[model samples]
Target: MSLRVQQMLGYTLLSAAFFIGFFHRFAPATFAEPIARTFDVGSTALGGLASMQFWVYTLMQIPAGVIVDRYGIRVPASVGTALVGIGAAVLALAPSFALAMCGPALVGFGMSIVFVSVMKNNAIWFTGQRFGFITGCTLLTAAMGSIASEAPAALLLRISAWQPIFLALSVLSLILAALLASFWRPPPAEDCGQLTARNKKERTKIFGTIRSVIARPQIWLIMLAISGTNGTFYAFAGLWGTPLLVHSFGFERDTAALAMTLSLVPYGLGSLFLGQISDKLRTRKAFIIAASGASTVAWVWLVSAGSATPVVAWICFVLLGLSSSQVVASFAAVKESVPDEATGTALSLVNMGVFLTTAIVQFGYGWLVASAGTGSTITGDLYRIALWLPAAISIAGLLGALKVSETFPREQHQNQPANTQMAIRGQLQPPYRDGD
Candidate 1:
């Protein structure tokens, strides 16, 4: 195959993995009652099920990054994809709560390997500009998975039951995994950076790479923003948004599913919309700050609006979704800040921060809601109080966005010949310059 065709196949398979990762993560939102009934659990217990996925995903972030960089994408990508299929099958046939919980958690472990691996592949195969666009495009695709898990999933549940849907998902994913393992070739040998054996000897010690990323002042600042903005959204939209709508607004389950779908569909579309705009503007910080700031304001309105008409609630949800596109900016910022060689570890650390915050909100927020007497009640007030946490965190995230100072760091490296600049960045820090 031509280099372009090979890279295309690689990314196509990666996108398939990304889609499954998002689908399983958000599937709990629409299936709350089924899950609770099947498992004979309460809100807090159900939240634990969702939390299990993010928590496992969070823990694997650094290790996945290291493994991708230390080994290569091929082995991990194939394994992770197949594991996700297996986990889905387990969920389909799960006979108890314990088994169902194990399913999402196992899927999460597989996903942790998938995302950073795909990102590292992007860094290896594509140029910097293409990388940013692909990042946006990647989120756009993943949001489709989230969307499927919402209203469409509710419709499917009405058709028969949730179990069979997951079973079909299992069969489809295994097929994709087989194709990825068999057909998707690596990037061209000449175009390779960290992906090839050419730079194997120039690799950083594992701890050294970890230290370098964590120690960077800018990375921490950006991560804080990502945690506040994208991280907050994951908690609210991923599992709680539908429940909040039903419990607070008096919408029927199916109606609330549609409203939630309206919200989440934009979350995907806006990534394509705003991400391209960011690319055209050649700025990450400006867009990130604006989007984070806007989303925080929307969140505040949602919490304070108090028992509005369902239409008003739907509008608020859509605004929140559109503004959540700032997440793409976070992805771009992290990718640009590091050398291509360290993209996996760097991006994975940032992902760890986001998922870590999501896990806390999933588990901790449920506990808080339960303790406050709103856990199973239909009181909007309690949900509003519970929402205060993510709103406050988003504020902190916007403040952190102000500290990230890069238009496009990776573009400069692109201008230099691969041998001279890419090699030097792998071994030593580039000359201490502005904002790096």
Candidate 2:
């Protein structure tokens, strides 16, 4: 195949890997009842089972970034895809819930690197202008996976059991992994992030690189902002959104699934829409600020609108989805702030917040709901209490957007140093132009 064709195929295969991970990430939401039944567990136990993915995923973030940086994307991405397939298969065939929890944990370990790898590859393969747009497009694609996990997945459960569905997903993941392994060969060793240092030296280099990234004050802000805004949204969308609908508005499982799916539609569109708009306008803070503020408003409205009507809830979900799109801005913002060499590390740092928060809140929120002592028939008051959390956290996004330095750094060809691209274990590159 031609180079362009190869790139396209590589991108597509990676996208498939991402889709599987995304689907599996949220699969537990719809599978809650069946999995609980099969495993003989209640809400607290079930939350632990489901949040296992995020916990392992959170633990793997820095390591994933380091590995991708030291080894590059192709092999890690392939391994990740295979691991997801293996995890899915484990989940499909497992006889017990405790055993099944191992599946998502393994899957999380595998998929932890995917988002960083994709971002790293994009930095190498595409221009800065195209990066934001492509990132949005990828999220749009993953949102499809999210939708599949909800409505279509709920539809599939009607025909066959959840075990069969995940079994099929396992086969699909392996197929994609094989394709990624065979078809994708990146450029020479020099252009990629994979390092060549000896064991002791490489270890020193790895820690140093991460240290530099952590040393930056703004990374924490970006992490907090994203954790609060987009990160919080992800927390809800992955686990709580469907149940909230079911309990609060008296929707059935299928109807709640559909509503959750509809809620995700705007997030996909928002990612694509905000990415293009931010790229075109050459601005990040404004879009992020607007998105964060708007998402908070929309989510709070959702709390009150619980009694208004389902249509109002749907509209709020859509609005929240659109606002959540500003998350791409955080990725873009962090990427621009740091040097190219640390791109994977920086992006992973922020990405870590999303899943870490999800894991923490997911496990915690389950009990929070259970503690209301309502037992299954959870009230609107409980729903409001649960749903209000993400809204409060999202304020961090607005604050981080303001505090982080503006690096109109998308025009990567401009002030970026050639030596910096060629340098590793070196001081960070200057991202700004010669100005005030």
Candidate 3:
């Protein structure tokens, strides 16, 4: 088969892997209450469970990056899929809450390997210029997975038990894992050869690659932006948004779920469209600033407007979705700033920071909401209070955008010579530059 065909097939299969991987993480949103009820645990305990998952992710990020760079994605990803499958099965059979925690913890440890590995592979396969759009599309894929867990998963749970739902997921996960192991190929041998330097002075250790990311001031800024964007969204989406809507607007759970789904649908679409625009425009900062700024405004309006018409709520939700995917800028900025040698590490570091903030913010948002009381009058007030959080984080991140000096230049890397611009597994591999 042609290299392009092979690369496309590989990416498609990887995307499927991503879908299942994310489904396991976000599936908790739909199952949280049920699991808690069955186990006699509270929301706080559930948050602790989720935190354990993130902690595994935090610990695994750099190691996973190194694994991706050295072994390619196949080994780590196949292991991760098997872990997730096993974890899901264990959670399904759990007779107690403690046993259930084992399932997500194992799954989280496994996911830590898969997420960075897939993203690093994408960065290697595609050029920096396309990172924003592709990353955005990837985020959109995760969002769709989140959406499925929210409504569709709930539907399944109504007809059957959560155990059955997880069983089906495990089967799907196993099939994808097998497909990835069978078809997943890395970048071309030439590209891998390029990574090896004949002289000792020319080569840096893997730890050096990670240190390079840590040394960059701008990387932290990008992390801040991503953290704020993700933290606010995930924190609110699963726990508080439904209650806030129902309490404030008198909407039913089904209506609230539909509204939440509507809110996220735009994000998936926006990521793809905005990503393409970013690639064409060759400008990153303006998009990041505009998207975050719009989202900040939307949050403020949501706080002050009270429940108002359902139409108004839907509009605000869509705006939030559109702005959330603007995180493509964070991914694009990292790709633009880092050298190809260190790209995997840099992106994984960014992912670590983003998710760390997400896990924390998710807990904080819930605590703040509950502390304010669930009384009718308190719902809108509590929402207003909550709205400021993501806004503040986003605004701080905008300053990070100011620090990024790199831009996706109009000149195509394809115009460069074959040696400098090698094709990887049939696709063009972008040349390494520290910053430009």
Candidate 4:
């Protein structure tokens, strides 16, 4: 195959891997109540089990990146996929709550590696200008997976128990793992090559690289935005959005699911569209600021307006989906800011920020809802609370965007290595200048 074909195929397979992995993490979302009832536990206990998965994923992101940096993408991606399969199998067979929780935690561990590996590989294969678009496309698949967890997931639960759903997912993960093993090869060993060190000296340098990324003040701000925005959305979308619709609007479960699905369908589309816009404009920061600002305003209106405006709520949620592309900006920023050699590590740092915040947000939202007492039916209030949390967090990201100067430092700074510039701009030489 031609190189372009190879890259496209690679992107396709990786996108598939991401889609399956994300679906596995999120597909069980609507089944929270079913799992709780099966285990005879309170909502808090059930949520805590799910939260454990996020916590592990969050904590492992940086290390997962390090593994990718030291080794290559194959081992981490392949092994992680196997782990997800194993976790799924375990969850499917679990006869107890404790055993069930183990499944998700294992899945989380495996998933952590998969996410970072895919992103790291993308950095090597794709251009900086395309990062936002590719990130959006990849995430669009992820969002589709989440949507599967939402509406179709609800339907699947009615067809069979959660066991079957997870078992099928496990099989899918294994298949994808095998496909990746067969097809996915890292770039030639000489392209900035994999970070290799013979002994302690190299390890220390790696450690130092990580420390440098961590010490940057703006990384924390970016992290805050990524985590807060993603966490709040995941918290509400995965666990609470449907419930909110049902209780607040007096809709049936299916109707609620439909509403949530409609709201989310636009998420991927918006990301795809806006990602292109960001690339064309050559300014991801402005896009991030605009998206976040819109989300904040839209969500505030959601909380204050209430049932008097269902259409308005729909509009606001769709707007939220569009704005959620701030993540693409974060991804672009991290890739652009760091040394090419540290791409994986830098991204891992950002992932740690995003997932950790997501865990906290989801857990906090769950705690708040649980505290409202059982079966009181306060979905509207729950959503409103969750919306406000993200809105506030997104503002931080918007502010952080103002501080970031480049989306692709080498290109923007006119300092790209010849090979990299050729690969990125699809030409062997920079645009000519008269003097040079």
Candidate 5:
């Protein structure tokens, strides 16, 4: 194959894994009611079930990064995809809630590696200038999975049992894994020699890279911003949003699923748009701030309106999805903040932040609802109360966005010595050029 065709094929395989991961990530939202009915659980328990994957995914991020950095993408990607397939099957066949819980945990563990591997793959195959755009494309692909998990999954649930649907997903995941193993190839060893030599010269150990990435304040700020925005989005759209609409706003399950699908469409499109725009403008911080600010405002509008205005609620959902697209810029900023060899680690750190916040928000929202003692008849007021947590999180993220240093136009660090690069990385607020 020609080089371009090869790159496209490899990227396609990697994106397939991401698509599966995202499908599992959000499938619980559509399945929540059925699963709860099957397990005889309340909102708190259901929330725990939904959040389980994220918790496992969050904890595995660093290890996944290390594995990708050390072993390269093919092995990890194929193995992770296969594991997801198994987990899905396990969940499909589970006879007990406890066993079903194991399914998400295993799926989360497998999915934890897929994204970092894809990010590393992009870094290897694509140019730095197109990084943001490519990352956006990756997210856009994953968003299709989210979209499928909503309306399509709901529709499927209408005709078929959830078990059969998940069994089908399991089969699909296994097929994708097989394709990955058969086709995915890393760059030629000779092609990577120079980059490896550079890293060796720097004596860049994995632990040292981890420490360096962790010590950078910009990474934390980026994490906070992501946690507040995208994390909140995941908390809602991934699980609670549909239920809130169904119980609180008097939406049918199918209609609620469609609404979440609408939100996800903008999220995917907005990521692509923001990635290209940020790349063209050569800016990241401004987009981050804008997205976080918009998300906070949307949350406030949602909480205050309290299902009294369905139109307002619909607008807030769409706005929240669009604003959460800041992740395209956020991931780009994180990539730019670190060295090439540390890309996987740095990206994993930021990703961990997203899932960690998501796990907390998902469970917390459920806990609040359960605490109200409303049982199956949770009221709009109770949901409004629970929503305040995410809104507060959005405000914190907005504040963090303000402190995130600009990372575009990375020319200044290109020619610097290794020591100078390290010094620059440590600076909390690097000086910016005019127009930055």
Candidate 6:
């Protein structure tokens, strides 16, 4: 096959894996009632079950990044995809709650590697200018999976039990894993020769590279910004949004899911366009700051609009998803903030912030809701109190956006042939110069 064909096939398969990861990520929210009924668990336990995935995913980010940096995408991506399949099958057959918990944890561990692999592949197969757009497309694809897990999955639940659905997911994931292993090819050596060489040379100093990535203030700021915006979105749309709507606003389950779908649809669409716009504008920080500000405003509106009408709630959800969609820009910013060789590490670090905050918010929200009461006893006022957590985090994200350095224009200007040669030889510092 031609290189272009190979790139297309490889990226497609990787995206398929990413899609499955996203489906599982949000599936619990759609099936929260059924899962709770099956296990006779309360809000806190369900939250813990869902948060299990984020916790494991959070812990695995650095290791996943290191493995991707060292071995490239093929072996790790294939194995990780298979693990997700196994986890789903485990969830399908689990005889008890504890065993079922293991399923999400395994899925989390498996999924932790997929995003870094996709981002690393994008860096290798595409040029720098298109990176933001490609990342946006990747997220757009992920949003489809999120959508599938929500409204469609809820509609399916009317006719079938959740177990059979997960079994089908398990089979699909396994097949995708097999295809990824068989057909996913790397970019041509000429395209990635320097990156491969750098990986080899840095293998012995992996810890040093990680430390350097961690030491960068820009990376930390990007992490805070993303954690606040995307983290809040995930905690809600991925798990709590539907429940809040159904229990608090008196919407039916399917209608609540449809509302979540509305949020995700815009989120996906916004990711696609906002990424392209960020690239065209040749700016990252501006979009990040704007997104953070918007997210903060949406949270405030949602919290203050007590017992909001369905239409008002829908507007807030849409705003939340759209504002958070600028997360694609944040990932691009992280990639641009570090050296090309350390891209995976930097991306992983920022990604860790997202899941870490997500896990906390998911668990914390559950704890807050559970503390107030249980099933049907939980009130809109209680949900409102829990929401302030994410709202405060969004404010922190806005602050981080303000502090993060502008990277796109500076990196574009510095990545000339001579600068590339210098970068390859480790003669230049990272492109994060102040006042760029």
lDDT for model 3? 0.70
Error of 5 at 184 (Å): 1.6
- Model 5 bad stretches (over 4 Å): 189-193, 199-204, 374-377, 409-436
* TM-scores vs. true structure, each candidate: 0.92, 0.90, 0.87, 0.87, 0.92, 0.94
Off by over 4 Å in 1: 193-199, 202-204, 374-378, 412-436
Candidate lDDT values, in order: 0.79, 0.77, 0.70, 0.71, 0.85, 0.86
- For model 4, how does the per-residue alpha-carbon lDDT over 1-436 read when each residue is reduced to its tens digit? 6666667777777777777777766654677878788888986787788777788998898888888777777777888888888898997888998888898899989988889888987787766678778887888888888778878888878889887888988898888788778777755444423322221234446787687678755456566656545656665566666666665556677776677777677777776776677777776667656666776676577667666556666676677666676777778767765566667788888888777767777776656665664576555666565555656666676566556544443446457566765543322323432111
In the range 1-436, model 3's lDDT, one tens digit per residue, is 7778777887776677677766776666677778777788987798777666766776777777777666667877888877878888888889987888888788877787778767876776676666676777787787787788778888888898788888888888888788878888776766545443421232347777677679876577677666656556665564556666766656787888778777777877887888888888887767766776776676666777764776776677678777778777667777766666666677778888877766766677767767876553365567556666666766776565555555463236557666654431112433332222
Between the candidate structures 3 and 6, which one is better when assessed by lDDT?
Answer: 6
Stretches off by above 4 angstroms in model 4 are: 189-204, 372-387, 412-436
Encode model 1's per-residue lDDT on 363-414: one tens digit a residue.
7666667788833554667876788888888888878777776646355666
As for model 3, its CA RMSD to the true structure in angstroms is 4.6
Task: Give the per-residue lDDT of model 2 (tens digit) for 333-354.
Answer: 7877766667788888888987
RMSD of each: 2.7, 3.5, 4.6, 5.4, 2.8, 2.3
lDDT (Cα, tens digit) per residue for candidate 5, span 292-383? 99999999888888647666777889999999888999998988887777888899999999999999888888788878855566677887
Best by TM-score: 6
What is the total number of backbone clashes in candidate 5?
A: 0
Error of 2 at 224 (Å): 1.7
Q: Which stretches of candidate 3 lie over 4 Å from their true place?
A: 191-193, 196-204, 374-380, 409-436
lDDT of 6 at 49: 88
How high a TM-score does candidate 6 get?
A: 0.94
For candidate 6, what is the lDDT?
Answer: 0.86
- State residue 67's C-alpha deviation in candidate 5, in Å: 1.1
